[model samples]
Target: MSDEEKRVLLNNAWCRDADASFAFGYALRADKFGIVIEGKCAKCGCAIVRCSY
Candidate 1:
């Protein structure tokens, strides 16, 4: 899936976006750097947690 499409799924989970734009406020800003999501995901809406480093 594409990045935009991934954002759509994230939006569905967080409901951060409802306009189908797949854009969220947090997406523009990052509290920490070098943060990443590991393991297989993006098919069943897994719980991808991110915390500040």
Candidate 2:
């Protein structure tokens, strides 16, 4: 996926989590392999999700 698309997806995901009052933070990284996302729940500072496309 393109960088822009990855960014939009990450933003949407984080917003959804926030709307639910589930504190979270996410990072979108792109490289030769592909797009990858690493997310953490701020409530407990634990890794909650990871996605690649």
Name the best candidate (by lDDT). Answer: 2
The root-mean-square deviation over C-alpha atoms between each candidate and the true structure, in angstroms, is 10.6, 5.1
Give the per-residue lDDT digits (tens) of candidate 1, residues 1-53.
46785554454432222222222233323345633332222443333433223
Q: Write the per-residue lDDT of candidate 2 for residues 1-53, one digit (tens) a residue.
A: 67787556655443234332124446666766666666665555555444455
Residue pairs of candidate 2 with colliding backbone atoms: none
Off by over 4 Å in 2: 1-23, 42-44
Off by over 4 Å in 1: 15-53
* Deviation (Å) of 29 in candidate 2: 1.0
- TM-score of each model, in listed order: 0.26, 0.37
| lDDT at 25, model 2 | 49
Predicted structure 2: lDDT: 0.53
